[model samples]
Target chain A: MKFIIQRDRLVHSVQEVMKAVTSRTTIPILTGIKINTTTEGITLTGSDSDISIQSFIPAEEDGNEIVEVQTSGDIVLNARFFSEIVKKLPMDTVEIEVQTNFQTIIRSGKAEFNLNGLDPEEYPHLPIIEEANLFKLPTDLLKTLIRQTVFAVSTSETRPILTGVNLKVENDELTCIATDSHRLAMRTANIESKINGTYSVVIPGKSLNELSKILDDTNELIEIVITENQVLFKAKNLLFFSRLLEGNYPDTSRLIPTDSKTDVIVKTKELLQAIDRASLLAKENRNNVVKLLTHDGGVIEVSSNTPEVGKVVEEIVAEAIEGEELKISFSAKFVMDALKALEGTDIKISFTGAMRPFVICPLHDDRMLQLILPVRTY
Target chain B: MKFIIQRDRLVHSVQEVMKAVTSRTTIPILTGIKINTTTEGITLTGSDSDISIQSFIPAEEDGNEIVEVQTSGDIVLNARFFSEIVKKLPMDTVEIEVQTNFQTIIRSGKAEFNLNGLDPEEYPHLPIIEEANLFKLPTDLLKTLIRQTVFAVSTSETRPILTGVNLKVENDELTCIATDSHRLAMRTANIESKINGTYSVVIPGKSLNELSKILDDTNELIEIVITENQVLFKAKNLLFFSRLLEGNYPDTSRLIPTDSKTDVIVKTKELLQAIDRASLLAKENRNNVVKLLTHDGGVIEVSSNTPEVGKVVEEIVAEAIEGEELKISFSAKFVMDALKALEGTDIKISFTGAMRPFVICPLHDDRMLQLILPVRTY
Candidate 1:
């Protein structure tokens, strides 16, 4: 590819695409980033088998010439080294030229780099998805949805489907759910979509995390297109594609309790701090379990004990107490994750019994809920 | 031990002492921090055999009462867990009481912790160093001296003594030197020592790094006392002791060249950036060597080549050039480290020939010098 591009613009685009570059050299071609120059602009693509990211730099942006193309061609260069060089280049503009032998030369001010390029034809092509099943959502909302649920996904590979987050879209609501048996997190939001489609696609949690990092918090809308086996997210000048996990997601509707024997309202920050202190001792134990005891007059006690380490007990005043008094023991990590995902100041936690699973939701909202299985602490 | 201490004051002291606590529980006692309460105040100590750190929280400081002691006793508790709990406790004052069996109860507001503590007698004691061989220096100067040379010490355990930095104090000058055979760094500063005692000690680089982090940038004087097998540093209410390396440190005086045929002065920032860019390509090569060629009229060219990765060429204008033009190749990492340690904006580099070791020092001063050996790149 022969093109002259602005240093800042090229650096920004290269960084976004470089996230998908494969670190492992099992397939040597996968370690290189493919660059293509056309009449419209210059495109850079980086991909592994799981996900791919592409960024385009147009010839002109807002009356400022970003890229000037002399010929239409393509080449692949080492992604890691190329990105590092571009970031540290000491100039405002950079010139890139490819020779007939596929040798690429990048020059900026007094610095010049000559790289051995590979033919772009050797690189794998990105799968294209139809726009028929596309939806639009604000970037900030999408980021928030990913942050709330992605951490609850199973990290183990025993059940491959559980490693991905189940994304379901129907009617005018979009719901995202992630569970690892020990805990479950769910978030629901409204988006604009024309066609009525129910997508039960399980996207790998790791891939979703990478995509979230590339999405800025701007007010711009993102277009999401889902195919049978792949999903594509398109922003202003960036394209992100991730392969979907194959298999049926477990039915988690029954896992959440439908009734509660007792319910208590507590401040999120107060409960989080108490749990954090109790966890100091619980972390030494194998299960890392913390007990919550609710007494009369809005008083709740949090305690944890380890035979060899120590024992900790703390009390937090609940906002309101309802029904009979109760005591439950659960993983401190699960409770902490649920509390962090909650946006409201006050949270209502419902307990079925001491041994059964409990539900935690916002004080006034039922759209988002979290469930955690209690541990039997003797 | 029975004492009540301000939460903020106790937390600050505990953090400093916990630096010596061992992460590996091979020696169980070494992982616990010992707290001694007396009529004067409370003293916290943590040790891991190689290094020991003690922080004292007095009864009153600057017209504020920091501790209220009811009795005199001592106990040892798990350093990591105790520090974490104290930091997150929800109270301004913390009350600590020890039972006859060494069961420690720490209470803050509505939170209480019962820890299984060990007798302080079981913990190893720090060596008592006399003030006869003491020297004094500003905390800021001492910190700077440690940072300038400690990074060059050998990290490998093959030669135990090489992993330590050598310190030599004479009548009015103190010098610190560190080398891993491939490169060497030395820094010297003037200090106040009236006794005219000459001493040489090898302190572990890891301990020095931790000590440097705890030392603030202030004009307060730090006292250094050298015992037969240990070195003690006393600053403010903190006391740090480190075991000396047994074997003798190799002499590095001959490594620095006194005369040179070629010398060049360049802006520190410009040279640093050029070296960083050239290193990107050299990183793929075996030795990460970058070559510098000097031409007439203060023009210098930097380049690096990898057989498979490609080559990079960059130029930087030198502030001043003298003597004959020459070309030499050296590890980019060593050059970068040397440039970062320099205090002045402009650095002067001296070279004897293409194969001899070069010296990098600040333009106006010679208090610090870095020597790097060139790689024979054909």
Candidate 2:
């Protein structure tokens, strides 16, 4: 097998696929990046049992020749070494060929690297995904969806189902929800990728996180297909496949409260900063809990106290405060994450009481809501 | 203690001293920063018994008020907490005051932090050095001296004395040497800091590294005062003190070769890159050994081979080749480090034999020399 390729394009594709490669894979062949070249292009694939990423570079892109003097062949090189070699090549173009005993030779300028490669026949085959029921979402919106809700997914294995984000499509709307029992993030958007029927799936949060890193924030559509055990996301020149977690996601609809005894509207930036400062000392607690108290006249005081460490108090003016004056304690990290995810200047926070869960949303839109269960403090 | 200081100035000073503070201190008070205020300014000190750093923010600088409404007092606050608080203060001016029981109130804008402070009297005192003799070197020059030799220090604790950089003054010159037995780096300069007599000391490689980070790259003179057990570096508003290593540094003068069988002149950058590529496969071996051989036509070949992994070969054209043909193997890491430290486009490398130690120096200068003993290959 022999091919001469542009070093930069090869380096970029290798890096993108490398995000899904795990060095800890017990299966030796899984540690390698399978390289296959056809008349159309070269495809580099890296995967573990749970996630796989494949990137392609065409022989000719927009009349520009990217790869030349190529013969169709297949070989797998150790991802780590291959990535480093392509990045440090001395020239703009690199030449790679395979000799006897599956030995691969990579030549560029005056440097030549001979790698003991693995047989492509020994590599695992990517599941053939059918071209039916293609559900699509714009790249930027999908990334935003992942970023806004992925952080709330459970990192604990006690409930493996909670470790995945739940996606539901119904009534021409797409809803994405992530919860770790203590906090929940829910976002609903009008589907830009019109579909035929309603569907639901649970995708591992870890997979979505890795996929988010490789995806560009563009309006280009990403087609997704889900089978019994696997889900695939297809973008231009790239394919991402992830294993779906087994088990049902817990119902979180009843977890969010519908009414509140106290509702406060405050500047998102001011409240976020105040909570951040108040939580500085509370960080030792790990839960990072802080208290928010509504006072007379439109003032809110945020504070946290760790007996042996110290205490912090931050005050911010509220645009309006109504209903009962109250105090509640919850994880400062949860509130801060929710605040950062909201793009609006002002947010409306509703608290039923000190112990009950509270809800926060943008004043101008209700497309997303974040809920956090208050921590019990004596 | 009470002072209203410019937030930026306080932040910078705190960051500088915090580098010397370690959280694993057995003495609880050492984890806190000792803050002392007088009519002149406020001094912040942090230490871990071995290294101490003190930064002072004067009451005024360049006719601008950096600190005001200050009262004389002393207190110690946890370095980690204090550093984080000062960095995130909401306003340009932060107010810090000491109340009863050493309780400290730090207020900026609408944020207030109450820190559980300790008595400054309990903090460890830095060693006292009699101000009898002082030697000075430009800040940038001292940093260069450090960068040129410190990387060769032995990281192994088996030979404790080899873990330091030896600094000696004699015959109107200052010489710095560091070696890990396998390799030695020697640098010398005409005494810019005029002295009456010769002096010698061994400074811990770790200490010099930390000090290098805290120092600015300006040419302002820094005063160095060495006592029996301590060395102090004093700048305009900063003081750094590091304890002297207990044992004498190893003598490496006899290790450098005085004569050579073959000499080759090559572009420093080209040689460095060739070794870098050749070493990519050698990195897994940890020792990272690479071999170089001279060819018939002013050409040098750099290569590395790992039994089961891979191998790389690179060739570079040399400017000159003289005396004899030779092939030598050495740690690629040592050669790369020496090449990076030398500031010359063309370097003359001398090889005494395949098995003997070789020396490298810039063709036009002799202020510094690097020697590396070749490794045995089966």
Candidate 3:
């Protein structure tokens, strides 16, 4: 294989594909990124069985030359070293050629690198992406959905199913939910889907996070297709594939309280900052528990006490407060994450009682909701 | 004790003192910062036995009210908790009051923090500074001296004395030197001193690093005093004290070769980048060894090879090459650090032979010099 390509284009493509490469894998060849050159373009692929990313650099784009292919072949190079070399190459154009015994030579200006490459025939093939049953969603919206719910996923391995965000599509709406049995985050979006029936699948939170980093914050559409055990996200010239987690996700809909005895509306930024301060001394606790007390004059007090450290009390005026006054204790980190994820000037919190879980949502938008289980405090 | 102080000034002072506070300390009280207030101003201090930092915020500065001290008293608060609380407070002015039983109340806007304060009597006193014999140096100059020599200090604990930078003052000049046996860095600077004879001491590299962080990048003169066991650096309203290392420092003046058989003059940035690229594949080796081969007409090749990984070769044009052609290998990280620390566009490197230690110095200036022992290659 022999090809000359722009250094910048190659660097970006290498970085995008490198996101899927893992250093520790059962198959040693999987640690290397597969590079293939065709008359049309060159493709770079990195995968570790769980997730795969493929980036293609076209030969010509908008009449501008990006790659010149002298021959078409394939070779696999160590992703870790190749990525570093391509990024630090001296010139705008780089030449790559494969010799006998899989020795690949990369030349740029006065610098040359001879890298040991593996035979392409020994590498595994990429997942066969079936384009049937495709659903298109704007890139920014998909990123937002992932950001709002992914943080709530369980980091523990005891309950493996809770480590993924459950995605349910029904009636032209897409709902994303993640919970760690302590806190739950749910977001609904009106996706551009024409399918009739409901489709449900649990996508690992880690996969969504890596996919988010590769995606640009543009409003362009990204086509997503889910099979029995794999999901594929296809953009302009990029393909991302993630393996689905095996198991049934828990039903958390009934856990969210439908009615509340007390309701409060407060500025999101103000509440977030207050809890952040209260958590300073409370961080030693298991949950970093912070207590909230409601007053009659539309005022709420946030407080936390760590016996040996100290205590902190913060008062923030609520825009509106109704029903009976109540005192509740919850993890400050959970509430802060929810406040930051839901974008708005103000948020509404509805509480059923001190022990029951409470729900928080943006006052102006009803699409995103976060629920937190109150901790039992003495 | 009660005082209302500007939050910004307090925050800066807290950060300055926090540099000396460490969570892991033999003396438990050392983890707390001692705060003392007089009619004139308020003082904040943090000490970890090895080093101590004190910052004073006066009642008035340039006709501006920075602090209003209603009463005078002393208390010690947990540095970790107090620092976090002060940084996240909401108001421009913070009111601190000591109630009964060492219970302190810190209030800002509608937020209040009740912290447990220790007895100020238990906090260790700062080192007594002898100002009779003092040396003054510009903050920026001192920072430069530290940056050039500190990095060469030994990170290994086999020889504790080598972990410090030796300072020698004589004939109205201060010379600083540091070496890890394999490499050495020496820097000389002219000082404004009237003291007679020579004053030599070994300042711990870790202490100089922390002192460098506290100092501002200004030309203002700072008073430095070195005694038998302690060194004190006095800035505007800050006092930094560090314990000096014991035992005599090794004389490495003869390590730097006075003559050379091969000389090369090259742009600092060009050679640095070339070696960086070569080190990409060579990093698996203990020293990340990179070899330099000089050609007849001012061109040199920098290359590195790992049998299993690959090899990289870079050709760079030098401004000048004199004497016999030679091949030398050195650690890429050492050369890069020296290149980054020195302020120059072009540098001159002198090699005695392929195995002898080489000297590198800025072409236009002779105040700073670096020496590296070549690694033996098979």
TM-score of each: 0.97, 0.98, 0.99
Q: What is the DockQ of each candidate?
A: 0.86, 0.88, 0.90
Chain A TM-score across all models, in listed order: 0.98, 0.98, 0.99
lDDT of 2 by residue, B1-378 (tens): 789999999999999999899999999999999999988889999998889999999998999989985689999999999999999889999999999999999999999999999988888788888877777888988898899999999999998878988888777677889999988888887755567677788889998999999999999999888787889999989999998888777667777788889999999999999999999999988679999999999999999999788999999999999989988888999999999988889999999999999999989989888888889872
Spell out the clash pairs found in candidate 1. none
- Return the DockQ of model 2: 0.88
Model 2: CA > 4 A from native: none
Which ten-residue region of model 3 chain B has the weakest summed lDDT? B190-199
Pairs of residues at least 3 apart in sequence or in different chains that clash in candidate 2: none
Ranking by TM-score: 3, 2, 1
* Lowest lDDT 10-residue stretch of candidate 1 chain B: B191-200
- Choose 1 or 2, whichever is better by DockQ: 2
Q: What is the TM-score of chain A in candidate 3?
A: 0.99
Give the candidate order by descending DockQ: 3, 2, 1
Compare the candidates by lDDT and give the number of the best one.
3
lDDT of 1: 0.90
Off by over 4 Å in 3: none
Q: Which candidate has the top score in TM-score? A: 3
**Chain B TM-score for each model?**
0.98, 0.97, 0.99
